[model samples]
Target: MTEKNVLIKSWADPITGACPVAEILRTLGGKHGPRILHCLTEGELHFLELTRAIDGISRKVLTDQLKEFEEQGLILRSPKNDARQRVGYSLTAKGDALCGVFGQLYDWSQYYR
Candidate 1:
């Protein structure tokens, strides 16, 4: 099969429901998902720090988003070690790999615009 056909076939499967690409898009398609993941690419950050980094995201939304990412194995939540009781979050290898995809999408957007 050709590369194009392989891609098309991968779009859906009975077992997985969605391919890796579609799964990724569905996960990061949210308003805050991409931003939160992007922020973590720099380094691990606490809950409050992520809120501060991503402006306009409410505490509720941020909390929910972080939980989803954790469940998906995209980000790691560290234990509270400081006096402030902050929880650090960092991207896993799987999550870090997606950063390139995001960058490519950004570049593609710029090219079109």
Candidate 2:
């Protein structure tokens, strides 16, 4: 099969252990997931920064979303390596790939607002 065919087959057959889009969609379908993912578009952010940017989100919800994103291999959460108990979150390569779609959606929202 061609490379493109292989890629499509991989994404289409979740049982083959290659497809992850379904899981990603499920996790990101939650209210906080899209918000958190959107924030990562600009740059890396710490937990506090994310919480502040997406107002009305509770600490528990943010924590859950971060954990889900990490588990989905969409975002990376790493320590600051400083004295402060700081951890930073950034989009992984897979996560970055979704930026185009997210950006389009963001732009489209302007029309509705």
Candidate 3:
């Protein structure tokens, strides 16, 4: 099989193809996803707070990433109880599980770099 076909086949597998770890990595592999997750590590925040916390991210990109993360069950979105009832975002149990992993990865990278 060609290299492209091999890549597609691996990702398409029903058994190992739908690897949770791989999915998490793929989701968090890019610049925006990880940053969004990191921002939520503190606590729940509204859309504007997230936008302010993560520097250099465009609103459109943040909105897209937030939607993707929510769909993946890595984050939870709820309506705020205040007057405006704005939507807020926070890490889900699955997302919280990555807290240690992020710390360890950061430490490891620090050692290497």
Candidate 4:
């Protein structure tokens, strides 16, 4: 085996076993995920508002992304009414913290952009 491969495996084995960074990236690295979180950072939004705010995202894609974000505890989904079944999405504490990181990243990128 190459020395680099051996070094990488040695460094990665223990750390990669419980890597939250990998999981976070997996959740937020998607095309819609960052945008979804960014919108939610503003305030709670209904399904239609989300689709409208994020141009070019289809309903199906938004639905899938919302479901995944909810499952990951990055966002909250609650029915707006008992009878109407309208749902609103908001960022959780964890989601807010992640978005703070996104804000920092955005500010940093402004230097180059």
Using TM-score as the measure, which candidate wins? 1
| Candidate 2 global TM-score | 0.74
TM-score of each model, paired residue for residue: 0.83, 0.74, 0.78, 0.80
**lDDT tens digits, residues 17-89, model 4?**
6666676888777788999999999899999899999999999999999999999999999888758688999
Local accuracy by lDDT, each model: 0.88, 0.85, 0.86, 0.89
Predicted structure 3: clash tally: 0
Q: Per model, how many backbone clashes are there?
A: 0, 0, 0, 0
Clashing pairs in 3: none
What TM-score does structure 3 among the candidates reach? Answer: 0.78
lDDT of 3: 0.86
Count of backbone collisions within predicted model 2: 0
Error of 3 at 18 (Å): 4.2
Better of 2 and 4 by lDDT: 4
| Model 2 poorest ten-residue lDDT run | 6-15
List runs of model 2 lying over 4 Å from the truth: 1-22, 106-113
Please give the ranking of all candidate structures by TM-score, highest first, separated by commas.
Answer: 1, 4, 3, 2
- Per-residue lDDT of 3-89 in model 1, one digit per residue for the tens? 788766445677967577677788777799999999999999988889999989999999999998999999999988778877899
lDDT of 4 at 10: 30
